[model samples]
Target: MEAGGWAAAYARLCREGGAEPQQSVVQQLRARAGAGLDLAARSLSRDTCGALGRLLRDAAPFPALALADCMLGDDGAKLLLHGLCSNTTVKSLDLKGNNLQAVGAEALGKLLQQNKSIQSLVLEWNSLGVWEEGFSLFCQGLSANRSLQRLDLRNNQINHEGAGELAAALKGNSSLQELDLRWNNVGLLGGRALLNCLHSNRTLRRLELAGNNVPSDILKAVEQAMDHNQDRQSILAENQSRTHVLSKEVLSLKEEKAKQFLNLMDTIDRQREEITRSSRQSSARVGQLQEALAERHSIVNSLKAKLQMAEAALALSEQKVHDLGELLSTAKQEQATMAERQAKDLQQQKQEAADREMKLLRDLSAANEKNLLLRNQVDELERRGKAQQDQLFQLKQDLTTTVADLRLRAVQAEERLDMEKRRFKQGLDDVESLRQKEVDHMTQHMEASERSMQERMQRLEAVRIGLEETGAESGQSCSACGTRPGGGGVNQSPEPGQAGGATAAGAPGGEATADDAVTRGGPGPLLAAEAGSRGGAGQGQPAEPAGGESSAAGGGAAAGPEQQGAGEGGRGEQGTRGAAGAGWAPAGRADSSGRAAGENCSPGAADESAVQQPPRGPAGQGGGDGRSPGEATDQGSRDLPDEGGGGTARQLPSERHSGLRAGVPAGHPQPQEVTRPRHLSLRRCYRTG
Candidate 1:
């Protein structure tokens, strides 16, 4: 049954199938146990076992239930014993092999303390004492079973220490008679502890220690009881048997002695026959005298007793008369005193009665006056209340109408506010979306520029290598270019507008990409070392040349007048480094820009304000710098008066600019009158300062 079905199952569970209510198995068990089944053996695994425990728990006289082989385990032990704690009649229990562990033992120990009728318990083959806790609990459980006479803890895990503890329990358990601790690992030490229990246990009459390897001294002690009590037992038994045998022997000897005496008596009687006749006459005379004397003594005793009784009656009569006279004198004296007090009491009572009557009349008169005043005040209040009621009625009607109007106005205002809020929310979402798109665009453009510059640098380095190799292979001029400028192509003299206008499309007269670098002859070989950041060039092994090309070129290119051998500032190369159109400028500049941008976004400064942008349009978005200063001034002067909730009455920009219109000519229509109904119309987008 489920936990929630306790009520329904209570009736149905106890009824067996196909049986009348009175004759059901549960009913018959209840009849035997009186009102409720006592011995219950419950097994969830099997019906018979479950019924046993349940029947025991429900029975009235409580059950000496045997729950062996039930396999109910610890939980079932708990359920069965939890019910038994309230039961009073159960005196014995056997929980032989239900797998009750330490926890189960502790639980049963607690129940045992509260149960009173349980007197014997068997936990054989259970895992008691397998753990310290279980052993301690089993010992403690003994304290509650003060009436327990037998405790069989056979085949348990009671070792030396546990056996010692059990022995100690026996010391306090005065009612326990038999204990079965067989088949445990109770070694020599444990057996000795049991022997110690036997030394003090007086109630134990029977013991089974056959399988136990007890010490010879302990066994001898059991045999030695005869030395202490043998005499008393033997004496009591022998005395009865000896008395019967002696009585028979004495009867036979007395019969033989009697026969001999009878013969002797016959001779003596013949001799004494004459004397017997003489003694009879004397005996008769003496009997008459003795009888007379006895009668005289009896009469004397009767006279003495009668005289003594008469004297006692005379003394009692005198005592009675004297007491009566004394009582009569006391009564008369008391009567005189009582009469004098009674007169004084009568006078006092009359005076009090008159005083009470006067006070009552005074109280009554005051009560009547108060009642009349109260009635007059009540009538005055009634008139005033009626007038106040009329005024209150008019006030109530006015309040009801005012409340209805206020409720309608509040609802209308709330609806308008909600519409304005939704518009502001949409504007905020649009603005946020635009900002995100702008950030993504900037990021993509930066990445594209960096990738292009890196590719261009790699190409420039490859071309430079090819030209140097061709120069070396040809042994006269670079095959890639086939020749140099040969001192210059059109060395125009000092043309003021024409400076070193180097184009990026040729490197020392060859191909180039977007980035171009130019350098005039300089000292120290003008080493404008550029690092590669992509592909095999990222290996960045400086482009070396065979036959000491760098050193050979350095001798004069390094010393040839360090800058542009020019006089004017028209060095048209934008970022002129030492390399002549080598395409390294864009790569270096792009790399630096990327580095700076990455640093800006590093976990350093807290502010991202450097990246934020202001809107430039009527929608209040985009990067706006086109609005003239004067236009802003005009708009500020034309704005409607600020309202409390940050929202002003929606106004067209032209309509608000009336002062500007007034200053203009009349023929040109005023913007205030000519509504543009566009960006000119007021857009209510509010921002916090």
Candidate 2:
């Protein structure tokens, strides 16, 4: 059949399918007829194959075509594929057993890249895998083809390299579901490659590697991988169908919700209209009530004004009546109570006067006894104080004598130092004179030795000249004479002046050591004697106070019987100023000036006078001393030195009072009235002092 017959068949197919014949298809067919090309013939020339490709390009009526065993080489395949590159109607293409090589395979790969309609491709029995380059290109195209699903490359001499390419293609190709690579040269390695690709390719459901030299284990693994892909494909299809049903349900639910929303909006609109009507009615009612309220407010204000006037008049009359009645009753009650109170006061006054007279008599007797006792204590204290003054004067005289002795010794030490300095200077001058004399002697000796050495050298020179005139035998004698002069000069050289220098240096060092010894030994005894005397004076000053306290205690014991009556009075007096007295004790010892000591002791006399006064009430007590106990305590505390300076003198109120009262006779009766006031006053005094 020629292109004319092919055109007739294409028209018949289009008519049967209820579609008009495309103009481009008809034109291509007419061209083939003119070229005398037959597309339906068993063996296609390159031109026929090209004509068929052009026909397929534009709305060709054929959906499936088989041109197996047609001997279409690489050129024919390229032409056919180039025309089919843009064709959409052809869904299946068969070029099996066409002797297509690498070039043809590349052309087919390119066609797959551009063609979207070709779903099944068969190139079995073709030498597509003769070169890996063409097969790689084909794999690339296969990866990109989305419409192609089933591929047959069976018996195409595909080795492990080709198989690897195909496996790579399968990894990326999602549309391909079945691949037949049976009766090829895919060995164990290719089989392994195919197995690995199955992990990534989910759409591939079938792979055939039969008749290839694949290991049994590899073939089994490949089978398992194919089965997994098939299961995945089935699952994907089922899921897709479920998704479609769910999407439809979601659309129906959305429409139902939209209808419900519209109904709710309509209901809200009706409620809003009703609410608006009710608000208008309520606003009118509020206006009416406001007018009525304004009328009632005016009437109530007029009534309030009349009631206020009436209430004011009634309140004024009632207040006046109540006040007059209260005044009359108070006046009557005051007259009766005044008479009874006057009688009671007269009786109470008489009793109080009698009690006061008795108390005064008793107080006067006790005060008289206390005053006598205090007078005696004052006399004793004055005598003891005079004795202490004598002792202090004696200590002052001793201190003065010791100070004079120290000054005299210091003067004597100065005189001795002057003598020692004179001696040291004289010795240094003598050593210097001796050193000069030695230096002169050494210089004179050196000059003499130099003169002798010059004379010897002249003699040797004369001998050498004489020997030279005599003969070679005389030369040895002259050499010996020359050596003698040099040896004599070396031996006769004066002992170096270093000896004189050593004497000069050693003499000065000895002088310095002697001077240091004189200075160190000179004032040492004088300073020690002065320090010892001062230390003795310091030791003696403190001992005087200790001795005075001991003596005072002894006197108090010796006069116990005679001063028994005065012990209570003395204790009261001591307690009154114990802190003041203790603070002044150190000041007295350190005074050096008698005026300061007297000034500090004067307060003791004042304290004794205060003790002689009769015990009085709180008011009279302040008047007696012209100052309170608290004021006295504060003054004493101010006078007291810090602990670091005062030593034991810095005592708390209780400790100071206890120490001062320790001299009181143990068997003496301490009257409560005398001791209580004195103890309290002692505490107050020490607390501040």
Candidate 3:
């Protein structure tokens, strides 16, 4: 039937039963006392049954469905059972006294097998077991149904055969807790089968077999088995509850232990990190101590070598003194013998003189003529001495004039050397200044490049973020609008190439600027300029002898005018010899100046220069007018500072004005002191570079 016709019929049925026909089926079901729909003892046609089945299948709110005494036979029962097969809401079904036969019983059995919500089924006053095949099928459905806990089959006219089938079904049925088969024709055979099934059936707690014509003994045994099953079920339920509580406690304890273990692991990790840090620090300290100890050992070894040299020198000096003492003793003995011989000879000559005095009177006239000739020879020698004295006076005046002229030339040379030194120092200062500017520019360029790179990275990051946001927005729009496959309303985000091009456009200028700065002469040009200045300074200065001559001139400043003039004349001669040597020693001078420039360019040069002041003082003093060039160089080498007692020789400048002042004696003037500030300025320039 159509749905409207069934709904109209249902309304008419509700009105006839004195229920409010204005309410819908669901409302009436919910408003009823048991939330059930009852059409019991009513004339329900096939159309009504279908309507009810449809309601049940569509998940109606009915918890109880009653079609008792409604005269719904096999077909009506099948219709109702069809809907209940898929129904989940109905927990109780009443289909008693409907004259249902084998067909209806089979349909009901199918309903029980499919419907999981129905816990109670009432089939009382039905002829369900009249057909063995139908009753057997119903038993089969009961064996599979797990939701039905109570089954009512009272007065269904079931005989021993049907009872045996039910007993067989009960052997596997674990859900049915109660079974009512009262007013049946069950005999000894059916009772015995039920009794045997109790051994395997654990969920069936109640079974009624009264008025079934069963034997008393079999009935009593079945009763006893049912009681035993109930008690066993109660005990199992209690044990399961206790086990659940214990499992909960174990889970909580496991969680707490895991948390504690994690905390301990964290603490150990922190302690291990601290230990590693301390060990690293200790290793570094040990390295420093080892270096210091090595330096001390080197100093001790050098001191031992010096001591050995001193001991050897002492032995040699002692041997020389012994040899001289022996020679003196031999000479003293020879002198005594010579004095004794002379005394003997004088006595013999006196005896001979006494004989000569007797003959002297006779020879007196001849001796007077010889004395007159000796007086004439003395007068000629006195005249020659006067002429030689006049010639010596004239030569002295000419020597004095030559000394004055040489002194004047020496002063002019000194002034020219001073001018060249000033020019060289100025050039070094300019080069240092230019180098400083280049370094500053490079630093600025690097900073600018770094900033530009950071900005570009930030821009790329922003573009990426924008792309992500655009993608997210596009996805949301697509899902919300359900756009067609070929739709073109949304615009796509810009590509990476376009964004990269924009960022790349501003980058080349900074790179080009950096490249230009490097090409314009970075540190390389600065070093070259410094070398050129050093070379020029070396070329402008006079040779090694000039340094000695200048010191002599300084010393001469303290003497009387005539003595100073004589000293200046000696200085001029020495200066001429230095000029001749300078012509041949240009290469050596260039090498020395280059070495000095290298030292000044080094990072530790300032510290070394400060530490080696004492050694330089002696070197400057050793380069005086009294020393030869070879001797001066040797003295400078001997005075060179030894680092950590290791004799690493270095050639430092010997004419440092500060060293000169320290080395000069108390009476001597420091003519080179005026150039000290210029040297200090040049050092400052090197340090800045």
Candidate 4:
């Protein structure tokens, strides 16, 4: 068909219409060399398609071929698929609009690798791209083409790597039914590698990725791989007619007797499940040996009841070992009769221990003469109790040196009673500054006797208004001026210890009234007994022998008492206690001082004669002498009633002369001084100023 008679009628019209070549008959069979070819719509050029591909490689197997729209380039598509590779008769081949570049798609992939009688192949609008090493050698010659069924690769700008090497040559081409790949760029990864080669392609029923940019779920995964390869070719045509049309040697002897009767019924159901699991493990070891033979028959009836309670405790330990061998033969005959009554009580305890050791050697020689007369009567009662404890330690060191000289005379009688209370508060502040300068000189003589009694009642109210204007000539000077203020004011009531006793009893004029001057006995009679009666009337005294010589000179100026008859009976009771503590008075002078203490014998009989006086001795322990006859009867009953209460006798004679010079002034101290040293007696400070 190399241009000899219209190219042999265009290769017998493309092998009698198994049709392909059109375009002006592949440009007149690419300018003439074509044994059996049809150049469809031909406008051939490229050297007339390389001389019609060397006349189909010196043409012999020329069954069908076509070079469509042949403006063929790339050396006329590598000289027409290299003359259809070792053409075993071109089975309908066609190159449409052949601009087949990559060496004409690698010479149509080595003409489908040694042309196994090319089954219908057509490369349309061929650029053959798959990054063109000739479309991966045309997918390895369409996977070693077994007799390639129809493939078209239309619009071959074949992309997704030439549609993944033509989807791996349609998964190793099992005679590809038909793969068109229309409009080129087989996108979505070459339409998912052609839907995974038609998912185990039974025989690619006709997968033609239409219009290239392939997606539609990869064309519904190639139509579910063509309905699963048409349900595996309708189950291989119902297992090839289910062997009933059998006779492949009687269907291989009925499939080997149905596989040896299903392998002997699966070895008789695994030996009947291993004989029902060895009869449930031999009925669980025969119920664990019947519960260990009922726990060894309850441990042989509890060891035959503990072997009959150990044979009744070995017959009560053989009758307590024959009653302890008859109490060890009656304790060896009571230890041989207590060793013959302990050898006759050891010969009567050795003759009563040698007559009780000679009556304990005559009672230990009368208890060693009564223990040496009780150690000489305990050394004569500890030497008469150590000489009566050295006479009570020299009578407690003479009563602690008379209580430290009566605490130094009670701290010098509390510093002479705080210096006689600061000299009786400076003699009552100098008798309240001489009674406030005699009450401001009696308030300026009662404001000059109230301005001279308001100018003598305004001159007796102007002489009774001039005696009622000299009526009856002044009525005798208004009755002698109202009896001259009631007899020149003898009224004197207000001395109840006077602090102006109610303004001297409201004295406009006066008249005695303070209980009649406290029954008339104080104020003027005892200034320290009138200085001891003017010192016994200046020695010429006879006032009862100067009051018994001023009570024996105040008991010889008593540093302590000598008791001159209790200081002459406390100076005869000191005038009713100086008129009741100088509330004062002048009425009968306390009944003449109670008759001078009933004739000087009553101050409790001079305090019972100074308490029967007779105690001075140690040479009268004189610290300034004299007074211990009970301190001369307590200093004549304490300075005769506090010096007869002159202004309460200036605080009871400095508290009874500091309790007769501290013989007792320790007022509240002793709980019990050695069994009562009479309140730990002190004495001696009578220094009054």
RMSD of each: 44.2, 48.7, 64.0, 34.9
C-alpha TM-scores of all predictions: 0.28, 0.36, 0.37, 0.20
Instruction: Give lDDT tens digits, candidate 1, residues 404-472.
Output: 989988998899889889988887787667545544543454456445444544554454344433333
Kindly list the per-residue Cα lDDT of model 2 for residues 1-689, writing each as its tens digit: 56677687656656664556655555556665434222332666665556556666776656776677778889988988998999887788888888888899899889989999999988889888888899899999999999998899998999999999999988898899889999999998899898898888888888888999999998888788788878888898899999999999999999999999999999999999999999999999999999999998999899899889988988998899789889988987897799789879988998899899899989998999999999999999999999999999999999999999999999999999998889988876876575555445434543553454345334533533442343233234334434211111000101222110000001111111000000000011111101111112211110111111111111000010011000011111222221111111110021111011111122122111011112122211111211223322312232343211121112222212211111111233211111123333333334332
Worst 10 residues of 3 by lDDT: 513-522
Candidate 3 lDDT over residue span 242-306, tens digit each: 88988998999999999999999999999999999999999999999999999999999999999
Give the total clashing residue pairs for model 3.
0
| Candidate whose TM-score is highest | 3
> Comparing candidate 2 with candidate 4, which one achieves the higher lDDT?
2
Error of 4 at 590 (Å): 36
Please estimate how well model 3 matches the true structure, expressed as its whole-model Cα lDDT.
0.53
Which portions of model 4 miss their true places by more than 4 Å?
A: 1-82, 89-116, 119-125, 128-147, 150-155, 158-175, 178-203, 206-211, 214-218, 237-689
Looking at model 2, the pairs that clash are 637-689
lDDT of 4 by residue, 280-388 (tens): 9999999999999999999999999999999999999999999999999999999999999999999999999999999999999999999999999999999999999
**In model 1, what lDDT does residue 159 have?**
84
lDDT (Cα, 0-100) at 93 in candidate 2:
84
**lDDT of prediction 2:** 0.53
